[model samples]
Target: MGMLGNTFDIEQIEVHKGPQSSVFGSNAIAGLISLRSKPITDNFQSGFSISLGDDSHKAVKGFQNIKISNFLKVRYIIDYNYRDGFRNNILNGMIDSNRKKELFSRLKVEFHPIDQVRILGTYINANLDNRYDVWSPDNNEQFETYTDSLGEDSQKTQGFSLRSKMKINEDFNLLFISTRSNTQLVHAYDGDWANDSYWLDEHQFDPDSTGYNYSFYEKNKRSRHNDSQELRLSFKNLVTGFYFNNLSEKDDAIGYLFGGLGDQADGRYDFKAYAGYFQIHHNVAKKLKVMFNYRLEKNMYKYVGNTYDNYYGDDLPLVNYESENTMMGYKGSLLYALSDNSNSYFSYAKGFKAGGVNQEPNLNEFERIFDPEFLTNIEIGIKTIMNNFGYVINAFFGNRNNQQVTISKQRNVGDPNSFYFYTANSTSGYIRGLEMDLNYILGSNFTFQSTFGILDTYVENFEYELIENVKTRAGDRETAMAPKYTASFGLKFEKMDYYFLTSASYKSKYYYSDSHNKRSSAYTLTNITIGKKIKDFNLNFWVRNIFDVKYTIRGFYFGLIPEEDYPNQLFESYGNPRHFGITLDYGL
Candidate 1:
């Protein structure tokens, strides 16, 4: 959802790095990106914002908040966005081949039953209509397209959450949270890049053997829902928490020619998980403090081929399993006051992640089983907040065992786009990294913030390459999708009722495939914004990718055409080009 970051309704975005299993869960292994919506105020508030940009991009946002009474309040938000693709169809001059449309709404209410109790309820609805049109092997330009059929990726989602806090005494409180969500997706694509006129001769030559239909199309789909609950109790020096979640998923990935044979691969998956945790903190001396946390977690999974509501089993019986696994997670930390403006912390944390079932059937006899993953982390960091400036620096060492890796299936001739993915585990790996974040308030109403991350990784004992069928030597390469370095810098200037901000971000080259030879090039992007506010009204202008650099974010190696049967070649998707926009805002 990075594209939605430009929306004016978002108040703040929080990034939590490293393994957070002691608090959040297994999904927060690498890191966590949290979006905090703009909070509702006590008095009445209303606002609207509009934006227009290049590529026919447009957006609208509006919100209202009211205090209904002394005991209750309500807030509502609505957002809409639309953008034309950067490239046009060479066939019909259609400019929106990669177009995207998004609509979202949210309702929130707060209740104060008494002096010691508080409750919040929220409901949300969202829809995304995205079109897919990317590159073909024959084309080298960023905006060129050669596919025959149009593709679509559409999703509809709805969810709700409830949170409550009860104050039991002067130094204790209880918290409860529950959430539910439902989602469905529709995705289809052109399996053959070229039109029938280009392949007519090859098809007619082998009609008796290949049949009459050769043109191809494919679709992969997902429908899933989940419910979860969490409870916590906090005291002066201790806290305890328990959480549970359940998820059910149904998937279909199928392909077919115009009139030829069709292949079907469908499955159902169910997951249930439970976790309990306890934490305690104490100050042993005037300038020293320590904390400890422990968590016990269990996860279960069941898979069948038939259906989500009707589980009768597939005829081929692709893969079936009912497995339960449990592990212990722990964390310990010590904090010392370095000076009146700075503090230092040392921490050690161990976390566990449950293994999951493979979505695709096994082509070879490797059992298609992945083991649970584990991580041990040790960190030493310092953080300080002074009147004019603040900075945080951290050095970390971590070991990840049984790291899960996803590999793309080897491509065949006729089904270039109908690819499936499966997962495996690395025996052990080592990762070391340094991170720094700095924010400074300048003398002339100017502010600056910058963050840098440098990482080094090695695969220790991995000896097998699944897709390429090769033996991997020690220290041969790093893990896939792990970048070596990333950095960002930003500057902000505000005086009176006006503000201007600009930022630049960079990421180093990284590997995507585990045959592990294919990699993406490093890239940098810049963005700037200017806005003014007057009597609850605001106007803004922004520009993104000011230099319009060409870069790729994802890549895969694949083969095409049954006639020549060539070796695999790299195919990639490019990032967006330069975009500039202006916005008018009220009470925002």
Candidate 2:
């Protein structure tokens, strides 16, 4: 969730969803995260590691590196981690434990000041603190299994970077990059049933005199600053080639807002953003490729305090808004090679997402304005590698426009004692997907890998008359953490010094509201690892989730009925249960 500085270190991570906004952008849509690290040869290395797990997890890591002769180099890394929370409240007996601490450090400097210059510098810092529990009630006896907690009340980040490369002969080349980043976050939560009715009728009384009281609060504070710059130019020979990429991004955000119910009363908001981009790529023969891109964005907003005319009886407390967005795109790809190993490709792309400012002070200022959401993607792919089997297949089609949903409505007008939710930019969608990956190398020891994915998402042309009597349909699916079959598999083994590993993951069945009504089921997880190497010291053992799957990953709902009268009461975000870990490594 945080990766700043070094603009792109992501080397290889293939998740599959297509068109990747011309080299990663548009939040990546939901896939594509490739990071690469570890370079600098002429070696002089160091390492240290320690880990212990199970409910009280702990970790420590270290690294120091050098390579100062061939070009220039330096590296340093330090890590520390701790974990405790596993949920347990039982009406304030505490122990929802939930604790997290993270500190990441990186310093890299490289210089090749002579033959065809090159330089790089990067620095990063990250901090995170978390607290848990947000829902519980699969029937904890009329709901009082204790609640109140939801994370990220604190988070911090800092980053800086510089990159340069140049080679002016032979074919020509130049590249430059600059970056700066800062971020802070506080997203609060506590929704103890907002307004309960003993979970509706879980046997009417006693044992605590029925349960469910009320409490829901919100406070979101965000401070972000970003500055980015990029430039690229390239030219090659042999037939022809050309490339140019330019990008500039600037963003500044400040926000503070609060929600009520209980202590009753607090509100404020602010937001801002600016963006820009440009791209070009060309190659007309050998497999062909062409690309073009454009982007411009702006947003500004401000709102202040109280407007409880009984939730909007007077409706006047939001009066500053501005938005501008422009996007243009073109893409082309064609790759063919049926002779050596195998290859095939096809693609199309277009994308945009911008439009904001809506904190719900009490609405009606046009629901605080919302628009801008567009997507167009088409893809086809095939790849094959012989000598030990390897495969990849992909398919995708998507179309979306003006869709920005998130409505939990139920204010009954500023404080029916309070329970509010708002978000708008309704309906226009279509999505289709399929992806597959497999690998096998059965001889050198044993190896196997697999991945599969499928998706069909919908909702189109919904005229939004406050949901148009609801049921804004078209195959309704795109929620429940957006799932429609996802899978992962892995196995590896090696002899000599001993090594073994296993992995599995899968997800299917979704619908967590958005009119599809609550539904979540389908889970599978497994992980195991074993390692041994006695010489320089290395030993490991691990087990994670291995069959203890309770499953829930995430869920939300505290008030506002609808979607089939709400109250399906299901809470069990348990996925990490059977965890046994041990690791040790030392080298110098």
Candidate 3:
């Protein structure tokens, strides 16, 4: 789903790092982010919030809980947000090219048949109509685009989940959960960043040139459905569960390729998985403890694709592929207590991910499929609390085999406009990192927190075919999005119904793409919030990126225009500029 209800509805958030697949299934090789919403309460409560900011930013959210009876309760939440784009389009005189509009609603029902049993059902719907014309040919300009066509990205999603918990007896507990979700998404964009006149003037009607009056427009419709169920039983330091999941997705796209040629493509994918897992904790010594977890999963996947060229009236061959695999993951940890408030732990985990077919029709059979990836992580950490201070430090190393990597390349040599992307398996890779967190509380009114981390990642013995038959060895290189170092510090003070918070974060330069050596410069951001409470109302003011730093979030290296001899150059999408906002909340 595109949106996860409203942030105000969330009660808790948990962050787990390094190889969580043993508990969360696949795609958790690095970590997992878990969010839990507040439960329905018997007490009647209602609240609303309004926010306003620069760039025409506006948001409103409200929630209410109603106690219908002694045994049942209902809660509903709704949120609406709209913001004008920060970027301007000089070609069309449009300032809302990257606008954002969103609507979200959630309904939850709770049933308490008895003291030992509780059931909860929740339904959520989200609508997003956002613009995506953020790309530009000139990075020197400030938040401006020259494209003639404005892009669009929109989604409509609906989801429902049911969960029940029962205490069968003093020694056993049962829990069941089921969820269903579906999303309809439409995305369209102008692939070429330049205007028609610019391209025409560059190529001078040269049919042999790929950029000759180049016009590229692409639109895709995606529909996805997912269903999952899980049953769990817990008994004194031991937990076991069985899970089943199914997912189906369909994508239909139309592309206005070079010279306005029409290309149509359709693809469908299905995935199903079943798994059983168990976790156990035991005390091995007076001051030591041990924990173990295991999971076995079987998964199946299928892909079908068809392509056609409408302008040329040519149909491509159909593609149908199916695959199945069985995988196992496990985690083990040992904990030792040094004092009543201090503890140390060591952990090891194995994570697994399944591979599937590629939807692209332009690749050969060998390039259309990739192998699964595996990660084994080992970590040692110490956590301690001494009076008003607490700290945690950990160091971890991970080894991955058959690592899946994606790269984009031109279909033909020197034809930069024919770019296509695909995923492939690397022989091996490794990552090592150290992280530390520290917090201090003083006088019950002032608190300070800081975190620092350093990471190093390298891929070994990996090579790819840059063109039809030209193999290019990609020597040992650092992983994309892996910064060398990161640090953050925050301070908060509260007294007399008022509070103030300030934080600063820094990150070192990092590679932006694994396929190339394009890197982004190091940057830092600062944020501050001040709030005051008056009776049942709360008012707050916040400012983010106070320095107005222009940092890159994404970048690509390719040839686009003739102004620079069509030489490979860096194109980047930047993060948001400085933003300041005010919010008011009322509760009853």
Specify the highest-TM-score model's number: 3
* Residues 1-588, model 1: lDDT tens digits: 213343446789888666677877777665678888887679999989888998999999899999999989999999998998786666556789778888888899999979899999989887888887775545455676656778778777888999999999999999999999888887887766555544565333254566754456777788889899999999999999999999998888665521122356677889999999999999999889999988888999888663121223333434676677787778899999989999999989887777876654443435355667888889899999999999999999989888766666643444565455667676788789999999999997899999999999876544444344654533357877789999999999999989999999999999876654688999999999998888877788999998888888788777665555545678777888889999998887
Residue 404 displacement (Å), model 3: 1.3
**Model 1 lDDT-worst window of ten:** 306-315
Off-target runs (Cα >4 Å) in candidate 2 are: 1-43, 53-55, 76-80, 85-88, 91-97, 101-107, 112-120, 125-129, 132-145, 154-158, 162-179, 182-186, 191-212, 219-223, 226-588
For model 3 the local lDDT of residue 526 reads: 98
What 10-residue stretch in candidate 2 is worst by lDDT? Answer: 248-257
RMSD of 3: 2.4
Of 1 and 3, the candidate ranking higher by lDDT: 3
Q: Pick the candidate with the highest lDDT.
A: 3
Per-residue lDDT, model 3, residue 469, is 79
Our tally of clashes for model 2 stands at 9
The per-candidate count of clashes, in order, stands at 0, 9, 0
Which sections of candidate 1 miss by over 4 Å? 1-8, 197-214, 257-262, 306-315, 363-367, 411-414, 461-475, 495-498, 561-563
Report lDDT per candidate: 0.78, 0.60, 0.86
Candidate 2 lDDT tens digits, 1-588: 343323222235545455454344445543465656665445788787788987677888777779877788887777766676655555455553355656667777888969898888877777767665545545332213444434344567777778898888978777777777677766555544222343334423233453423334454556666656666666662222222222222222221123332232334444444444555556666665555544444444444444333443543353445454444433456666665788888867776665666655556666677876777888888999999998988888878777666655444322222344555666677778888999999999999999998988876434333332444332355743578889999999989988999999899867654533566778888999999888988898988877777665554444333223344343334444677889898873
lDDT of 1: 0.78
